[model samples]
Target: QRDRFQTLAEYYRIKHGSIGPLRSWMDRHWTVSRDKIETSELHRLIVALNFPVIYTTNYDRNLEVAFEIHGVEYVKVANARDVSKARRDVPYIVKFHGDFDDDSSLVLTETDYLDRLSFDSPLDVRFRSDALGSTVLFIGYSLSDLNIRLLLHRLWQTWSRSGYEADRPPSFIFMAHRDPVEEAVLARWGITVVTGDDDDPEKGLLGFLSRLAALVEANPSDPPTLESGGELP
Candidate 1:
């Protein structure tokens, strides 16, 4: 989550303004899977829903590849400028973390995280706007990333504090494996928790998405509205 990214970002800022070295470091230390089913599922769901997705991960280009494999056109956001351009495209994948191909964009390390804290860059405005408008679905994320959590929480608070409707917060989804403890924390902030069997998340997600697509198809004339009355119609 936020803390993990912040830690990586901070480290990247100090090490070389990039996590170029961390790749090697992780390979030497961590025993993690480079192949993730969820990554592929991410692309499948995106194509199924025809929705743009933004990801924040200090990992490889698995997401991008997933899109390509599905024959879904996609664009990567390397900087702020890509945001507007991607917004106009068929489908866009915004990488909040630096991509593997670009070492400099990698936000890893304690210093890098701290530096990004003052996200005074040009992309800040675009990030804020997109976050406000979209229904964000968070998957493969842990609640322990305090920095990321803080950023999200602050964004929600800022929107509310600026005299917007108190109940009209942006929609967010937490695809959970087993209702982690963090679900409550996210719920408090208006994030909906979706728990499915972790071992079969792909199938579960696919089923859920299929039903959602049908619902949208069935209600094309109505323009979906939540009974909870949060999002604007």
Candidate 2:
């Protein structure tokens, strides 16, 4: 007889018997450093947009590396301690999921995801605060995660409750392919769905980001008020 694992958490739990080994494995292998980061045109385009704060559901440090490669200074807020170091003058690269350096902060496995649902964690609180006033732009984010959908819905609910949903700054999501169901739902949630020409998701996303970058570069004195909100899966 053989055992089949249906989920990543199940596999890791059975293989290592606990969370410790999984995190150790990531720490030993998945901590992608700046020099180790390969060239990425999409990343270059995102940085060029100059979003004040970038939030990611990714566990790696690729975004930070992108900023470093472009000579852009960024404060990485992976945990509570890192939050104090954050400044308004420079860009903020926030790790909403977790970070390689901190095992406790990593939000992997089914358990970690469930724990974040309450939205009381420091990172979650920070997001709720920043997102309230900023014109957020979500790039390449998937709607599969319940956490993200809940977060988006709650953000809308908060604004609506304030009787200022009409006054809320517009937020956007860039999708490579247009889905009527997704577009309509997001629209109802006050998020405008933006699409591009390319049918291929990666190409479409790259094209979209390239256009935004060009717009920002052309108007340095009055760049678009965009902020980082990506999930590079």
Itemize residue pairs with steric clashes in candidate 2.
none
Best by lDDT: 2
Write down the lDDT of every candidate, Cα atoms only: 0.60, 0.78
* Per-residue accuracy of model 1 over 21-100 as CA lDDT, tens digit each: 76666535543334563455555665656665565564566656666667778788766667656656566666676666
lDDT of 1: 0.60
Location of the lowest summed lDDT over 10 successive residues in candidate 1: 224-233
| Candidate 1: residue 53 lDDT (0-100) | 58
Off by over 4 Å in 2: 1-7, 10-18, 27-38, 224-233
RMSD of each: 5.1, 5.0
lDDT, model 2: 0.78
Task: Please list the residue runs of candidate 1 whose C-alpha ends up more than 4 Å from where it truly belongs after superposition.
Answer: 1-21, 24-42, 84-87, 167-169, 175-184, 197-207, 213-233
Task: Name the candidate that leads on TM-score.
Answer: 2
